[model samples]
Target: MTLPTPMPDTPHTSAAPFASPSAAHAPTTLRAWVCHDYGGAEVLELQTRPGPTPGPRDVLVRVLAASVSSADVRIRTQNLPRGFGLLGRLAFGLARPRQPVLGTDVAGVVEAVGRDVQGFQPGDAVLGVAGVAMGCHAEYCVLPATKPLVHKPARLSFVEAASLPFGGLAALHFLNKAQVRAGERVLVIGASGAVGSAMVQLARHRGALVTGVCSAGNVALVLALGAHDVVDYTAQDFTQTAQRWDVIADTVGASSFATCLASLNEHGRYLSVAGSLMELLARPRGTRRSIGGPAPERVQDLQMLVDLARAGALQPVVDRTYPFTDLPAAHAYVETGRKRGAVVVVAWPEP
Candidate 1:
């Protein structure tokens, strides 16, 4: 349960000479799960393609593990949150996903770094988030060195490290926006999920009295994550309670400003990680504010999460892992909306 502390210096795992940016022009063939037309789990196909080449400022990673998240499901099925259907189509693709490969979180080895890149080199174990520019489902992923890429701690395996970025980054973004103060009451809906679980832990880390709302089966899990209280939504509606929180975060698209307005304190913030367009456009009734839309991708925020993970302040919650070949199965499980945390796909098992 405890990951080892990372050294201040970046860890090196291989000593081979890395290809220069110019040498990367001729890419080798690699296997990848590609989604040409989005419809169902069957849309993902494992196919052979030329490996991605790094640009002048890019870093090419040989993925060891990747996570299948709710975003992947949305991109796959076009089942977006309540009002963003047309917007999603425009951003993704009218016919299908603009990006054929769908993955966000990845833990891998730095196969090569661009000529102008620093702080990373060939053979460094690393974890990164590609965000909306999804491509981690492939054997090789190319990202800018300035993204959320960082050295993987020595103690955590590929699967464990792969679970951190997607959820942690989102939670950190919204929590920072909410400006949760110490000793304030914080309520996290969908607390058993990826973003929600990270929200609970990160809020607690910031010294808030965190309360988690989840199903009956996840009460113990949420409590173990350092929540001060747990509300089982299966048995009770959290909004119906007399209690009001300083910050209420809905991570599963379950609660809206109209529904949670009365439950919020005078100056409380309602964070909607999966909010619809109308909810995002809704005006504040009073002092209570609703914050929504996608969280911005920041390397600094990702670095903060890596530091917290190294200090044992953040713990990754991986509900299950599947072989790289079973990625379609992972997508199916995530679509069910029952996963406790990240669903990881191990491309290269740890030795």
Candidate 2:
């Protein structure tokens, strides 16, 4: 839902008293990273401001931890991939980001629920993605009960649970659309990334012969995630090799349908998780087909990811963790494009 009022364009300097994270009663205001402009990490300012109120169908959560993803970086810097510039501006904002608190994946304890909410109550540990609502990068966030919110399993901590939704959800959506089958030859490009890592594990668990293409530094990490083979993209190009795959999934914008067409086997499926505009608009040429678009944010998918994590089938690779106050540092680190897996922020530690 669009907020009724846009946050102030000026910095907030009021030192008025506000409830701490440990407070029992609901807080009228909460601390959050607010970005009023489209720029680098420097644009993000930590300020104490009014928090969002839960509507009749909404649930308010005390955010324990949240993951800083590529999506967050893109929105913050307005540095989307080529061909997505206009789309990004239109969807986000022409002058600035539509959502100032830029985070999608969240893990925390429920603090309050609207009257119409069900199956969740105050004090329940929960984890889910806010998706385009994107307010998880704060001490508290509101999620609609009908969204992807679900109970957090005891096996995963706040950070680990925070790592699952963004990557795992996208991986699950693409894999399902591709209809991956047991014993099929599957190749995941950029296998060290959030989505790639999740796809590696999920594909392996589906009994596919999974091959991961990544830099040499992430080869062992991909192997540990159950990929049968690792193609060091630094050493050689997997597409130029003689190997053919039934499914070729590009988690990063490394390869497109045209580039990987000849490398695909008969009836192969190509998944473009971060597709360029041309790639998204391109049609299937031959026996192989391509799939690309926004990944659906489904509660069922989030639940499946949680279940897989509980069963040890999905392992969330968190490369680094940052204190909530150091979220700008986290954003700077992610901007380097070197971090593997998720970059998590401790939103507010458990009391």
Candidate 3:
């Protein structure tokens, strides 16, 4: 679908004013989904909390929609590997969450922009990732203007735009690392899932022959997303297949390093969004290998995904959307590992 061209200079008056007395008197509060002490979906509770204020280089977005990701699930459960666990504990709070909000991807209207910000102004429709300080699950979030924030594609609804940042950037960054070329074969495991589905589309867009691996139910969906082939994981072993790919994107991390390596051709790249405990343990040793490299985490790569979405070359695959009050249910769905694409949390009432 083609997106409407964005008029960046056009002023939008539909957004609620952030400077209103109602907002100021209650500046210390807003409704948000908070994870007081992380565990399962049960940990997420809707509560009133202090709203975030934009810094000099930040934009305070009135979030319309936000998404639940596997990364959020990992952090919520404290299931990350040793280093990540320590980092999370320090960065986020040692006992409870420093940033209790659990969302990363967001699509929203700019309610306010910091004094030094220039590129975006109040009322701009935008989508991007909000890293460690994840307050997107609330009514508002403050993100650095210099981060990946970009104009939202007019073709996508807020719910759809909310699904892109994390998975899209991960796919784009991994593909760039893989250096995929036209006619090269690309295999995306967990293709029906968020990151996997994104990788499939992106690899195809790069003119690579893309094969998507998913359950039988999602084969058509994967194929519709531009995959050249779809492998039903329930019916067969993709790693043992005769095909050798130039790049293998293992989104779920269900496949081991050995299995990924085995499926690759010479000088082929193996990429994954979710890292296993084993991979983290072996990182030091594998860092020097040609087959294994450091994981992708470039902010510029996120901008590239934003551009792709705006250009209509990328589209977020949303599995389901829950109201702001249903955050626990959304978290539960993410934990199940059966969601076809992204699980979005709509933060505000629709127009």
Candidate 4:
């Protein structure tokens, strides 16, 4: 696949350079999961495709690990807005995924760098957004140096690093939007899920006392992730409790706006990482009216997450790892909505 022309190099900022990996023989052809229709994970098929050529400022990464998220599932099922449908089909290919690949959050070693690229060479260990472009569920995925790509933390393995980006970014964004502070009480709904689990830790790292809502099975897990308290959603509704929270981070969108609002302290923020098609479509109108609501803030949040990871204040809670060939099963497991943490897809053959 051919990438867009690279962007001009800007003055080197204070940001740290990506860590270069050990060089290895590069492959010309790569295996990837491709999809022709909008449906379940079954629609995804394995195929060989021409490896992507990096434009100036781009790095071609040999994917060692990737992850499946709810966003990928939505795209696969055609459950997003009309624009997503139209643009996804047009940009990806109508009637099927234009990129055909599914996994997004990626962690890998760089295979080659574009001519104009700086800070990254032929071999670099990195993690970043896959955007809506090249599918990361393959042997290689390309990302611009200017994108959210950052050096992988030395403490994390490729699979662990791959699981962090999307959920970490989303959780960080919502927590910041909430402006949680020390001693403040924060409630995280769906706290055992990928993004929810991240919120549990990030909020705690910010010094806020966090209460996580999840099933009984995951209460212990949420607590282990740094939540000060855990509310079992199956046994009781958190909103009915006497405790008033300064912030409510709803990752599942499982509760109504009214319920969330009812639980919040005065002038408290209610942030939702997951939203319906109607909510996304109505977002612009809400913004135009100066009414604050859930918004999908991406790139900037991703950068913040990288900082936290580098600082050792945040870490991914990866619940399961699947071989690349079992991507279908991974997708199916994610759809169950019971996953305790991020589901990782490891591209490298398991030793």
Model 2 C-alpha lDDT per residue in residues 159-231, reported as the tens digit of each score: 7788889999999999999999999999999898889999999999999999999998888888999999999
lDDT of 4 at 66: 86
- In candidate 2, residue 131 scores what lDDT? 93
How many clashes in each candidate? 0, 0, 0, 4
| Candidate achieving higher TM-score, 1 or 4 | 1
lDDT of the structure predicted as candidate 1: 0.84
Over the full model, what C-alpha lDDT does candidate 2 score relative to the true structure?
0.84
Pairs of residues clashing in candidate 2? none
TM-score attained by model 2: 0.92
Candidate 1 stretches with Cα past 4 Å from truth are 1-27, 348-351
Q: Per-residue lDDT tens digits of candidate 3, residues 169-284?
A: 77776787768899999888899888888888899999999999999998988998899888899999987777888777778877755666667777676675565545544431
The 10 consecutive residues of candidate 3 with the worst lDDT sum are 1-10
Q: Once model 1 is optimally superposed onto the true structure by TM-score, how far is the C-alpha of residue 215 displaced, in angstroms?
A: 0.9
Residue 291 C-alpha lDDT in model 1: 91
Best-matching candidate per TM-score: 1
Model 4 spans with C-alpha error above 4 angstroms: 1-26, 80-94, 277-304, 349-351
Candidate 4, residues 1-351: lDDT per residue as tens digits? Answer: 001212211121112333443222345578888876888878988888876666777777877778888778777887653335665456655777766787777887777777777776655677778766548888888787656777766666676677787678778767766667998898888898888888888999989999999988888788888999888888998878788887777788776445566677776666656654444443322212111233353656776776776777776677777778878888888888777778777744532
Clashing pairs in 4: 21-123, 21-124, 92-98, 93-98
- Candidate 2 lDDT at 173 equals 95
